[model samples]
Target: MVDTNRITGAAKDIGGKIQGAVGDLTGSKHDSVEGRLREAGGQAENLYGQAKDTVRHAADEAYHYAEDFYEQGGHSLRRGTREVSRQVAEYPLASLVVAGLVGFGLGLLVNASRD
Candidate 1:
């Protein structure tokens, strides 16, 4: 996952430095300016690549964290369901009473909403 832009930018920066040095030795302002411009462009490209890499890494981390959280949530739900089932089986009459109460409460809520 080496970024091409980063590599290209580094090469351009090196070339620009050499060009600038030659321009200085030959007393050519045009060459010097061109070299400076190239150097700046290379720096911008390198920064862009670095930013892209940072964002991608952050997104990958967030995705993995969310995936782990979801898996844990699922496991917790399954365990809770199993516990409830076992409790209901161990106390059938109590479970029936609780179910009746819940139904009655839901019916009350529905009637209140209608009113």
Candidate 2:
């Protein structure tokens, strides 16, 4: 969840930079090619890590929204049932109507808050 690949990618990138710097300082062609290759590989890895992070974030957001919506629906159902039971025991038609209205408003509020 913490994106280990991204961390690894970053380390690779830094290592590549250091290697490239060292190769340049030492004037070694072999080291220079190796360094360039490593740098390219690291850049690719960093791009991949960024894509992965984006996907993970989107998925997490979707999951949270679904969970919140489900919980809100469940709570609304429970409250509605309780209100109906109370209304039935207290006042017949009036309480029923009022309870329904209140429950509806609460449901709307929950939905709005999710948005």
Candidate 3:
């Protein structure tokens, strides 16, 4: 994305240079000083635009990274669920026993916490 401030700042800088040159030709110190100040302001605006672009780019990269990470995580979770489903279908009795054991363990943990 192009920054408008950068373009505006560049135009301002060019205008300042021309103004300063004209001031010099006419021997006007005040106009020359004003032109230099305008140039400095333009440079500052350009720098601000650059900084904003850098931050925006960084944010975009981070958002893409997070999006990719979440997509991968979701894929892994789906794969894991499918694997567990296949395993339970292959060994229903074993799966039931494992579930019972897990429930009993959780109950024990809960009771212990109450004490």
Write down the lDDT of every candidate, Cα atoms only: 0.89, 0.86, 0.89
In model 2, where do residues sit more than 4 Å from their true spots? 79-115
The candidate scoring highest on TM-score is 1
The 10-residue segment of model 2 with minimum total lDDT is 1-10
User: Tens digit of lDDT per residue, candidate 2, span 13-92?
Assistant: 88888888898999987787788788778878878988988999999999999999999999999999999788788888
Off by over 4 Å in 1: none
Poorest 10 consecutive residues by lDDT, candidate 1? 1-10
Per-residue lDDT tens digits of candidate 3, residues 1-115? 9678888887788778877888899999988888888888888888888888899999999999999999999999999999999999999999999999999999999999999
TM-score of model number 1: 0.91
Choose 2 or 3, whichever is better by lDDT.
3
TM-score of each: 0.91, 0.61, 0.87
> Against the true structure, candidate 2 has what lDDT?
0.86
